[model samples]
Target: MSETVREKANQSLAMVEEVTAVVLPEPAAANAVVPLEKANKTQSAEIKRRMAEIDMEDTQSIVSFGSAAQAELQEISQAMLADVRNKDVGPAGDSLRSIVSTIRGFSVSELDVRRKRSWWEKLLGKAAPFAKFTAQFEKVQGQIDRITDNLLSHEHTLLKDIKSLDMLYEKTLQFYDELALYIAAGEAKLADLDATVIPAKEAEVSKAAEADQVMVAQELRDMRAARDDLERRVHDLKLTRQVTMQSLPSIRLVQENDKSLVTKINSTLVNTVPLWETQLAQAVTIQRSAEAANAVREANDLTNELLTSNAKNLRESNKMIRQEMERGVFDIEAVKQANADLIGTIEESLQIADEGKAKRAAAEKELQEMEANLRDTLAAAKAKKTGLGDTAGGAVPG
Candidate 1:
């Protein structure tokens, strides 16, 4: 319960105590007897007046106070019933249920930083570990905002209900006080009828004539009936007052429930929400640190792999360089093979040259032979021509 409500309840209790102290006395004093005598006289006069006016046939008219009191009590009961009916807390209960459901729906696990990513997302460099968590955080923050608003609305409702219950509490107390007054008045009226009016009527009935006695006895009977009716009415009022007394605690209980709900709502808004937000922020920061550490670890591994590969390549290149530097520019085996090939080529050329020289010499010898034969044939032909020419000249001269 809120302090204000507690204080109001204390004040109400004190007021009730003060009122009770003033109204309920220990006993009547000796001086109070004079007022009692005067009250009895006044009651006798009132009873006489009522008897004079009341109809013998109509018993309802005999006790107007009881009828009025009963009517008033009924009215009070109906009004209280209406008030109790109107003060429905079903909506408040629903709001509380909704708030609880909203709270339950908030799961920190939804903000898991290690949520699985698709292969393509990783390959495309879109593996944002924080994106899902951030979205979930935003969604949860939105829920918190909605819950805060709902709690505020519920708090308002509870405060209003508490205030209304306070009024109802005061009203119930007032009804109780009124019922007490009614019961006391009815009891006093009944006492006056039994003590003063009925006895007087009985005495008159004995002294009067028979017909007058009959009338007096009828009035006396009416007075007794009115007294019975009033007694019943007072008992009913006491019962009504008992209901009001019971209602006081019921009203306080409802008021206390409202106050407690208000306190819960205020605590959620003031404490729980902020703490959750802070913790969520801390969780995000921790997750980011973990992601950074993982990234650094991956980078270190990549660097180590790159350095190892480069070292392997460097070792291979250095071995090749050392082999090249330790050897001459031309290999001795290659030079020796090249010289053998050159000598074979020169020998083959010399052999072809020798064969060509032999063939040319043979052809020259054949040409000389042909020339000598032609010279011999020319000499023989010349001798033969000279002889023929001499023989022809000799023949021509003869």
Candidate 2:
């Protein structure tokens, strides 16, 4: 194959390798396989081995999914589940649900899991123990996101640098080509100076007499100056080639750096990012699953509390109803008799008030008639006195 095609093929192979074999830095906390603080020496060593397995990027690690590590993780998770089940407090149901959900979610069918999986993918599938601590998984999720963001940013910077390197590489090649052309032209000029200009000037000096020697010497001096100028130009071009060769090292370094960055970016894009997305989905599912379990548990507790309170209330109400049913607190006969007596008293009081009102009306009529009779009698007496006074005045005038 041609050199360009061969280079392209190598790049493709490198990309594939980078994608499948991304080796990320291990998180400090996640590397601890178990949460046991006071484990024995043997257990601690075993835990360390498991943690190392988790960090391993090779398929040969025994702790990879479907391997012995899976079984060990399952056993540890089950033990933790049993401990939780035996406990009377804490979000036991929620914790159990989360663990079960994670385990089931991680276990992939043939259709879901591709035949060719990286060691990290296997490790992720085998990490059933992480399900037990949903909170810790969530915390780890944040860290993973931050790391992924940084890797993406790094990839961006690398791409920019690689672009710059490519531009520089092209410019350098162009410079070398132009310098080569300049050097070729300078060499040709040097040949011409030696073959023609120097020989002609020497022949002219030799043929001249002693009287013409001074003029020939001046002409020789000018020819020598021209030859020196040509030689200097050739030397300058050679030096430029040397300087260009010196710059090759730095260019190659940049090219190497560009290749390394490309490999890293490919790794992140294919492996690290995918792993993160899968784990994050698992984490979120576990969180929501735990929350749902806790919600159900809380609802059950509330229902029980309400039921108990209602039962107490019903009991108190039943007691009152039972008392009323068994024996009466007030006399029904007495209440009826009192109500009848009150109606009779009210009726009697109404009758007496009507009679008094009638009497008052008759008395007021009689008093008004008596006052009218007295006014009429006084008016008749005044008229008689006036007539008597009038008769007495007329008799006196006669």
Largest TM-score belongs to which candidate? 1
Q: Model 2: what TM-score?
A: 0.37
Structural similarity to truth (TM-score) of each candidate: 0.63, 0.37
Per model, how many backbone clashes are there? Answer: 0, 0
- Those runs of model 2 whose alpha carbons end farther than 4 Å from true positions after fitting are 1-136, 209-212, 246-252, 280-398
The best candidate by lDDT is 1
Cα RMSD to the true fold for all candidates:
10.5, 29.9
lDDT to native, each model: 0.62, 0.52
Q: Report the C-alpha lDDT of model 2 over 202-316, residue by residue, as the tens digit.
A: 8988999999989998877866665565556446655655555445455556446555655654454456545655765775676567667767999999999999999999999
> Residues 1-398, candidate 1, lDDT per residue (tens digit)?
23343344344433333322322212222122222234466644543443344442465644454345456546655655675576535665665566567556656564545577779888987736577677666776677666566556556655655665565666656556545444555555567678897888889889999879888888878777766766775676667667666766766666666565666656665556667778777887887787888789999999999999999999999999999998898898889999999999899899889999998899889999998777666666665777864344333211
